[model samples]
Target chain A: MRGRRAFFGFLGKEVRHILRDWQTLLVLIGMPVAQVVLFGYAVRSDIRGINLAIVAPQPDAATASLASRFMDATDTYRVVASVADAASLEPQFRDGRVRQALMLPSGLAGALGRGEPVTIAVVTDGADPNTGSLMEASTLAIVRAWDAGRTGRRAGPRIDVETRMRFNPTLESVNLFVPGLIAYVLTIVSALMTAITIVREKEIGTMEMLLASPLRPYQIVLGKVAPYVALGFLDVVLVLVAARLIFGVPVRGSNALMLAESLLYILTALGMGIVISTSTSTQRVAMMAALAGTMLPTLLLSGFIFPVSAMPWPLQAASNVVPARWFVVITRGVMLKGAGLADLWRETLILAGFTAALFVVGIRRLAVRLA
Target chain B: MKAATREPAGVGSGAAHPATNVGAAVQARGLTKRFGSVLALDHVSFEVAPGELFGFIGPDGAGKTTLFRLLTSLYLPDEGESRVIGHDPATDMWALRRRLGYMPGRFSLYPDLTVIENLQFYASVFDTTVAAQMDTIEPIWRQLAPFAGRRAAALSGGMKQKLALCCALVHSPSILFLDEPTTGVDAVSRREFWDLLARLREGGMTMLVSTPYMDEASRCDRVALMQQGRILRIDRPSAVRAAFPRPLLAVTAAGEGAAVRIGLLAALREHPDAASVWPFGSTLHFTDRRAGPDPARLATELGEWLAARGIAATVRPISATIEDAFMWDMTSAEPAA
Candidate 1:
């Protein structure tokens, strides 16, 4: 009973420390909401408001009607310019006034009247390959739809291909990022925050007094990290709520499972933090180590922005060790895919393994006495 | 004190072996520690009697902090062993930690925490409450009560020290280890802090305090003069001063000026019979080569010697202080190096 009271006292002290630092508290609570809003609005994969130039050497009813079709096919394509010659569209593409250009052959109405085979070319700027390809595909889809509507019969022998995006059908990038955002925010809030807090005690010499007290090293470690766990959970909930209310992302799976997995991941990140604090004697070094050691790996190697399967073999193997990698999978699986324990037990096990291993290393590395 | 009766029974029993079963409140036999290439504490050994106020007096880097850390179990010795309140700091630190209170060399309390909050936090950590040990810390806490709501960082150096002391004493530990409790504090506050320690000592509380100020040594029941990780001497303040083995003289010129004092010191160092000369405050301390000499004869001779050198000065034989004894031991022990 006495030990439990001491642990709570230590835990209360840790909470008081965080509460008194208003700037840090602001960052702790506000950073997640701000990051979610920023990334949700800024990072987009869907094509919208794309400028298009129609090149027609001859103006005719067919060409004018086709230009109208491009303009009327949703707001995805906005006819920014209509040039009489294909040569005139060069400056439009060069200066980025136009992102895509649809070129119709000369005498296109006469050819269609003669029922002759003719091809139309779709030109696009490929500076950013991802958006460039998306624009081209969207332009093609519009042109195919227009052609099919114009012809009474189907176009000669074509292999029609249809693609369906599962989970996030509209392919909203925010849907993918929200899950990763939970992992990212928790990693920073748990690992980086805990590491710096622990190192601050060492820097200010309070760790010496704590070590000299009746509290065991494990008790100290647990007390120091307990507050962060709560804060991390709050961050996860905040990000989840913002994702749902603001970004329209859904947690299709069990809310309890998502929360449980997030708690587990927070523990893993905090374990990483404890290991970091044990090795560093100053706050500056611990901050740098946490950023470089945990944050960087979570951002780059966890398949948050980039797929781990597409990385090199060595990087793929390295990604397996980043706790955030497993967490991202678990969160995306549970939040988006509605996966339960049956589908996510492997990732869950790996995360638990990481937490266990990191905590054992952290506790063992923590010295009972000063070196 | 309310908690005085709660003192552990095994403290003075001396039941265990390992050279610490001498019934001392704190004991060490050849405790040593090293940090990289620096030998922080050599094979140092000492003991503090129960209810005694023991002080380790030394300048910076004299291993006073290192010794306190070892005694408090904040550090483990590389060689030998130590026992605090009859519990080996190495093997039995849990019991030792609960029974001992440590105020580290630095202000270890949460700077952002209010004074009362810091006190309450420490009290709870020890499985006690501030109200329970109010009698033990009442003297210091009464002074700190006015600033109870203030953050510790805003307190004056002296107030900070008092709050730190209050926090250490909140649990009413059997013994206390205070490392340089008054290093940066003002002179008046330093005196006040020592007076507080004296009151605590009167209550039969065993304490081990370290300080870099030599004048503070006189207030300790017994002081260990430490230097370069070694204890030069350990005894009562008066006895340590009396142990100065050389005849010493205090020389000062009639005119009070920096130039006159500097000139007097230079000339005294050049004297053939002068063993060592150091500037002490407004006067210069002069030691002769001969061991035991009559004070009047030596003073007259030194006065005449300075007069013959065309520099008139007043020379008087003065008894050694703890500082003088410390300087003597430090200088005498340096020749071998």
Candidate 2:
């Protein structure tokens, strides 16, 4: 098409605008880097040094060894108090001295030696469900290991189930957070940046000039979003670099595939931006709409912070429509799980389908407005 | 005048009284456009010959910008048809776009880009470069050469308008649509801008320029005098002025004091024969309610009437300008059937 040359010319113009405008530069480079560093370190979900109180009323060597082994299980928990009686366990939890408490009954070792059933009570603060559940799981794992070791020396009832954490063996939240962070940064930056830039053109009245020119609506949209795709990919690299080098998050899968999928997601975001810009005529309204439209959906609905499966049925269905949800799945699958396209073709296809759908809708809306 | 005042054709009426000659650059028949409930351009029809400097003269909200936008193919009309360079703007907008250059009423060039960048960008959009059309825009671009590195937003109003015009012409289109090229410009700069247009006319470029200033009407080869989205008259500037049906009197208060001016204005408005008395600079242009064959007797009567109010004034008959004709047309309720 003869419009190809004009497309590049307009693309160059949009690139120059992005390069010259400090606000756009700030949004493009500064915000993503800052949010990644913040989310990686300060705002991360890794919980450490959860205080635990142990109460062993019998005061036997087996109960004390069990308590000591639980404390040494992982850095996630610490034995803050060793209560002499069960009466003081409740006080330690109430006074905020301990977030979790482990109670070994008086006959725990006797019951094991005599082949009688024994019950260990693990109490945790339910104020924060995430931390509480994590503490409870840690206590169970330690207790299970101790019982299994004792059962090997003698005959006892045990179910041997080996649990393997496939992707992040250490279960480090950094690995999980990094992928979500990339989704968030790319969505907000690319979508918001493209939206505000187009709205600015409309506000300044240059859009009418473009419409009056020989440049078609598709070329105009492409010229606008082509630069943003590059910017978004650059942000993807910056986030991945910071996540890998700074936070020690890994990229175990194909980096090329990860980047290609990221580019597809970025296109989806840019398409959303064009749609928003077409609906709005001013930069302020566009900015507000972008933030409201992309930020909340990416953060809450994309499984970036909360798990989609654990969400309500309606919310889970809604998340399927969020572009970032599929991207996040692809990012986690490729980067954390070392998966290939064969493993992630479904998510990739969904993202591609979304990009195409949004681009079509955006172009049609733009044509309507221009008409 | 008969050709100029031909009634706009009704909706979907094909080629009624085609004013489009072989040399016509643009033609519109019953081109009515509405924005929601607001009637922007109503049953408006006109044509411009190739290489002619045509002007649409009206005050603000007179639909001058709307007509320019419609002809530029930026908006589709609700009814009727418009052809630019022998192509319908409604259907053949893309083909027409390559042949037309439009400078919108607002300063719309990239504000962050340098003047040269803006020029180069627009030229490239037309699949050419600015260097290819240097001779065409040289007279204007040379004036803007020193400020090539300056951002468009930093340029003064006149310089900004010049840069806009230069960008619009960078592609060397067959027709140029300038919507109020000198609305807010200083008097000196406005004159210079029109002088530039006159030079463009010499090189045989078809231009359709709109302006709110009545004085600039004389600069055009012909003008469509518009008000409230309706064309009242279209003719040469002198003819439009001569079309003013009533005689005009320039009433000058014979004192330098502001109080004398105010008192004279108040006394004249109170006069029974004063049809309309509007301030024109320090003096006043007064139109009598009654048309009379005897101008000398009317002037004498106006002088005695001012003296009767103890305000010294002089009344003299003067030729009506476009402004007088516009005011007369605006105040009239209906166009002559």
How closely does chain A match the true chain A in each prediction, as TM-score? 0.80, 0.88
Q: What would the per-residue lDDT of candidate 2 be over residues A139-217, giving only the tens digit for each residue?
A: 6666776787874335333433224224454457778877888889888877888888888878898987887888877
lDDT of 2 by residue, B1-337 (tens): 3233333222221232234456578888888899999999988887777888888998898899888888888789998788899888888888898888999998889989999999999988899988889999999999999999999999988999999999899999899999999978999889989989999999999999999999999999887888788887777787788867776899998889888888888888988888788888888988888876566678888898878877788999888999988887766634542
Please give the lDDT score at residue A198 for candidate 2.
80
lDDT of 2: 0.82
- Cα lDDT for residue A70, model 1? 81
* Predicted structure with the largest DockQ when compared to the true one: 1
Model 2 interface DockQ? 0.64
The global C-alpha lDDT for each of the candidates, from Candidate 1 onward, is 0.86, 0.82
List candidate 1 stretches off by more than 4 Å. A43-45, A52-71, A79-124, A133-165, B1-21
Enumerate clash totals for all models, in the order shown.
Answer: 0, 0
- Candidate 2 stretches greater than 4 Å from native: A57-62, A84-87, A105-120, A140-166, A368-371, B1-21, B334-337
